[model samples]
Target: MILEFRTYRLKPGTSEDFLRVMAEDSVPLLEKAGLRVVDFGRSLVAEDGHEEAYLIRAFSSLEEHERQEREFYGSEAWLAGPREAIVSRIESYHTIAIETSEEAVEALGRR
Candidate 1:
């Protein structure tokens, strides 16, 4: 299995706004595109003098993750939704794909 770990650094004073939009707008759109959003929350550990939020998504493969994300980004739903606003709040974003054991996957509630 593969996990797509995404971290976002928000602009100063924008963390709360970002999280609100993430839950109400982004997560639902991602789910509609078949992305299995496993978890998302503010980071307990600070980094780079920015407020950080992370999202973990389980996927069958990195290829699938890329395909789904590409489609999602191009969709009319995304264009019409909060994409622009959400991105404007982010100072930086990063993503990494990791291979994981079945046990680890299940432990992440990805069954």
Candidate 2:
């Protein structure tokens, strides 16, 4: 499986609003494209007070991930959305899981 990691920095004092919008709107939109939000949260303390959030999406393969991105950008969710207002900066990473160590996978499952 492949994981898509997205790190975000929200505008000052907008962490709560950002999380709410992500939960109510952004997440659902991604779900429609077969991208699952395995994890997401904000940092309690960060340099410059810039909140950090991340999402882990599991993909069947690299090709599937690419297809999802294409569909996501072309969808209505991307064309018109409140996400533009909430996110200040975004960094994305695509990783391939060579081994789903039992302990690691189990730990994540518990959460």
Candidate 3:
């Protein structure tokens, strides 16, 4: 299994709106497109600057992750959905994907 962790540095004071869009729209949309959204929420403290948030997902493999994300991004469901609201609030973001055991993933979910 593989895990994809996305960390976002959002525009100041946008955490509430950003997380709302993510929970209410983005997560469901990605799941509909065959992605597993493990968890997502605002961080307790900003990592670098502004407001910080994160999204974690589980994928069968890196190739599957890449393909699914590509299709989801290109799909009209995304372009016409919460894409603007989700993207506009982000100042910057980074992703880290790595192979992991189910136990490891379960541990993350427990948090």
Provide the overall lDDT of each model, using Cα atoms, as 2-decimal numbers: 0.86, 0.63, 0.90
Whose lDDT is higher: candidate 1's or candidate 3's? 3
TM-score of each: 0.90, 0.72, 0.93
lDDT of 1 by residue, 71-110 (tens): 9899999999989879999999999989987667668763
Q: On a 0 to 100 scale, what is the lDDT of residue 13 in model 2?
A: 68
Order of quality (TM-score)? 3, 1, 2
How far in Å is the alpha carbon of 105 misplaced in model 1? 2.8
Q: List the residue pairs that clash in candidate 2.
A: none
**Error in Å for residue 54 of model 3:** 0.1
Residue 82 lDDT, candidate 3, scale 0-100: 97
Candidate 3, poorest ten consecutive residues by summed lDDT: 102-111
**Candidate with the larger TM-score of 1 and 3:** 3
Shift in Å, residue 61, candidate 2: 0.7
